[model samples]
Target: MEQSNTTLPSETWANSSQSPAPMGAPYMAAAMLLFATFLVGLVGNGLYLWVLVMKMKRTVTTIWFLHLVSCSVLFTLLIPFFTVYILLGFHWVFGTGMCKVLSACTHLGMFSSAFLLALISLDRYTFTCHPIWSRRYRTMSWAQKLVAGVWLCSFALSVPYLVFQETSELESSRITCVDYYDTSRDQDRAETQAWRQHTHVVLFLVRFLLGFLLPFCIIAGCYSQMGLKMMEKGLARSGKPFKVMVAAVVSFFFGWLPYHLYYGLTLFKDLSKSLMGICQLICIAMFCFNVCFTPILYLFVGQTFHQVLRTSLFTLVKTAFYEDLDSDGVGPDSSGRIR
Candidate 1:
């Protein structure tokens, strides 16, 4: 949530020259979008969590999905503070510990969510492509172990962010949590920038390949083969769930791709200031959108959507109208005889 003093030249020029358009407009718009996204993510993911835990019977798939929704919910929870910070011109009033916690939570949730999706894709692949072996080995115990492994791996991967993030007083005397590096001891700031360049490149490549590209390719291939098999077998009678699953995969890729691409492209120096700002905005928007959309995709993709909805509605009506009725009597008061 910290605003760096290193403003792009275009931003400085706009603030100095552009009198017709208010400088805070973009910030306000971004804040509003983030807040709206947060609300949708919170409500949508909350519903998914509730249905998974309370309405749907426990199953391997539902258990995995429950973990996915929970991570997304945690991701969305960080948005309000971010929204408020942007609205307040990117001030960090939340203290250093919270800053680190929030930053780490965001990264952890992202990595964990991606890992879960990859896990789900792999599960589906095994279920569809290697049914016999999968049947022999794909128990709930295996799923639980995989989930635990994912959490541990994700936590380990995010340790660098937790280590590097710290609060410091900038030249403006404003306290902000930033990723600080000791480059002053080097010959010049350019050397530090060069080191950052290399680090960013490596990190971006690794993240893009592991987090985005590999998972997407696996998902795309698995779903493609599944669809082909279903079509060939004439088992497309239950096509809705298949279509929903495909849509979910497609949305997942499209939603996160722009963000990752922008993140990677930021390592290069060819992008203009306005373009960089736009990219940043797009990345932020996409990140928020992804957190909000995953649970919705799960809601619609799973075959249990209608079943869960019907059960919930039925439960609500029964609770509202019949909970107070005497079970022993169970007879009409005046129009019918008690039996």
Candidate 2:
């Protein structure tokens, strides 16, 4: 519920080498949250990546999803540096080059994540609702082309961040990557403000529509029809693939809706500073939760749950008590008659 205050004093702070004021408790809390998020994301996404690469065979769906999870892993790798920066009161100890790279990577991850979800939803629609037509046109090669298109689009969308990001020394002398257009000293500050207002309005509309609203509508509609089809066909309990599909779609919404809502609210100029900060923190938390929860949902939401669990447990037991079986030349099968 934190709000952002956009008004800045006319005179820019002259001193550029001063240390930032200590953030004390809030900074510590942000750091802790980032650490916890990093650990969860690393473990969960790592396991998913391992399973996808080393265990599961390639399919059209799996190919796209593998890239999606790879992007999340790359994004989460930056959490520690971000945590340190936030804990140090927003100081950017890393150089300006790192600022651009980190900012671009973060934006790329976000844009790609949303677009992948949209792509998955579209694929589901094609496969389930129009299977014959999809089979004719949606070959593995087609999927690869679509994924490539998505990444290209995402990179293009993030180009503005590369241009806009700059490291500057703040009033307290700490360096930070400031993402705002400063025109307070211009005689046409009013025009500048108006231009900013228009830009924000357009950007918000595009982001909400392309990134959130349209994708959610497509996903929801596709899943609703899919669920209805399953029910009508009396396949609800027949171990249908649609059940797993439903769970994944639902998890995607639950994980991302909060973060997007928070992002939308930042467009309001009247929002308070404290509320903006809190909302920013909450959005970050929600994003991390999305990253951590997705692999679990993917792993457990289908008929593979029991099989995977059993296989994992069996492997653990074998590794634990049979460490010497290899070196001792023991053969369990040969001596099994003792049982």
Candidate 3:
């Protein structure tokens, strides 16, 4: 019962002393997926960043995209370390500092991405429902400040990872990175166990709420209203933008929901080990795929970005980030089209 439930599958091999190679098939696949995702996400998000920051004009839309890509790129950069960790049969040769740093980065990436998606959805809702307000307030300066606050919040939430992450040398002579949340180390056994369980439950609930559930609610609410507005205004003729929006929302929903659900269920005491392993492997696959696929998902599902991408690819990248504006500054941009 001393084992942290948050410990990943790498730390759950049951026999850490034995090299994981023999039973590392699923892990090996995850490592390979991470490697491939790292390559694609790095290049794709990197190029998108270059395009947004360097080639495109500075606007609120471009600003949002720039940071989104930054998050993706930052997360993608950490993929190699994870892949190496898995390749090494989950051994923590990277030391305690790296262990803490990696955990923080992982949480930071997830938090920022989730927050950004929610913000994006809110932006769409405001633009569609309150165009005058969005236009007057959604300046580049405002957007920049808002994004800074997001990063600050994300970092704040990630602080727990740095605090709890530790590299523990197992009895098997293998070192594993894990969440050592038992703060009452000097307390009685019952007290320590209670503290650890409390910490685990609190962390899991907080992460699930902020990282997935709350954001999802915001997204669903915003998009639902937007859809109603579009339908009422007879603006659903094209179907392309609506389709893209639906696709993006659905993708985001499915992408992280199951991972959260699986981990949340793991909190229950009765779940069997075999079930946990299967769920863990599936979650890991989804996690890896999402890190690589998110930016591309936005790129392809965004009608504006997709159209520009179709025209001449990189040559037209600059146009993709441009907001659709009219002389009155309340044009298609007000419709909350993903630019």
Candidate 4:
């Protein structure tokens, strides 16, 4: 998913200014996978977002979840750009302007989704661990502010990528869009290339920290603490909402971690050139699978597998939005049903 910046010899299509990549099974697989994922992700996220937005009542959890699903939906909408490029055998027919916009959008979607997931985790943690504190501060208005902050940060970071994207034609009569850090054709700009590479490294590190490592750590920590508290307090039994949260968090980590790894290994040239191509397909497939499964996982989690299997898709979706998550905004009472 992050292979847009690798520097390779002309034969490999790594140098966008040189030659297009040769047709191969890897490219074919990428195109097919992206197309399939695009369809699934679009339908799943769109339905889930609509339900959350139009049917559910305003609550802290619902607001954060709505933002998370919205980000995934936006990400899936951009999948056709990659799908078309792969099917065209790495020829970027999209103009330079679109090249920059799409590239920036991809980065924005990726980073924003991670940020929102972190926000959701933090909310879950605070609400579960310190119910009294959350009851006071976890308002829908506050959730909206956090959502805005995440998007603003995502946009700020993505601007640098827009400035760095460049498009050029190859000897094989194809145009390609690539990050400007590829120094293969810029030997004369040795100093400039050095600076760009340095910037790329710094940006990659920051992205890794913010997008994958830090967010996952917070999520893990939050869930871990919640688990300990649940057990310690004799609440060993899991609720429907807890089950859904686990599914969402687990799926999210598995989906995003591989993409980050692909970026690292490719950016550092740690893997062989041939191996990197395989990794690219794997990463893209994983990322797409992640986007496709997230909404479905959330929807299904509110019910049993047997329940989902027995019902029609339309019925199942309608039922998912009606789940109010009684523990979300309620405090304990004399009956002691609230968390």
TM-scores vs. true structure, each candidate: 0.76, 0.77, 0.83, 0.87
For candidate 2, the per-residue lDDT at 193 reads 73
Question: Model 4 residue 209 lDDT?
Answer: 95
Q: Report the lDDT tens digits of candidate 3 across residue range 219-322.
A: 99998898898888977422333343455456556666766776576567687766766765666666656666665665555446556545666644443455
Give the Cα error of residue 104 in candidate 2, in Å. Answer: 2.1
Ranking by TM-score: 4, 3, 2, 1
Q: Is candidate 1 or candidate 2 better by TM-score?
A: 2
RMSD to native, candidate 1? 9.4
Residue range 1-339, candidate 1, lDDT tens digits? 111100100111111111112326766777788788888988877776775677544556656767877887776777777666565555557887876666567666656767777787777667666768877887778889999998898788666556655565544544544543311234557877677556556655765686678878777777777778778877542243334445556656766677676655555556676776676566566666677665556454443656657654434211211110122132224642222
The reply for model 3, stretches above 4 Å from the true place, is 1-22, 181-188, 237-248, 302-310, 327-339
lDDT by residue (tens digit), candidate 4, 1-339:
223201110112333422237668767876787788889988898988877777556667667777777778877887787777767777778788887777777777777877887787788788778979988998778888989999999899778767777676766677777766753464457787778778768767987898779888988898889888888887753455566667777877877676667667645645566666666666666777778888788778757788778877765654543323444533333553332
**lDDT (C-alpha, whole model) for all candidates:** 0.57, 0.57, 0.64, 0.68
Name model 1 segments beyond 4 Å from true: 1-23, 181-193, 237-244, 300-339
Candidate 4, residue 62: lDDT = 67
Residue 227 lDDT in candidate 4: 83
Model 4 misplacement above 4 A: 1-20, 183-186, 312-315, 318-339
- What's the CA RMSD for each of the models? 9.4, 9.4, 5.1, 4.7
The regions of model 2 sitting more than 4 angstroms off are 1-21, 182-188, 237-248, 302-309, 313-339
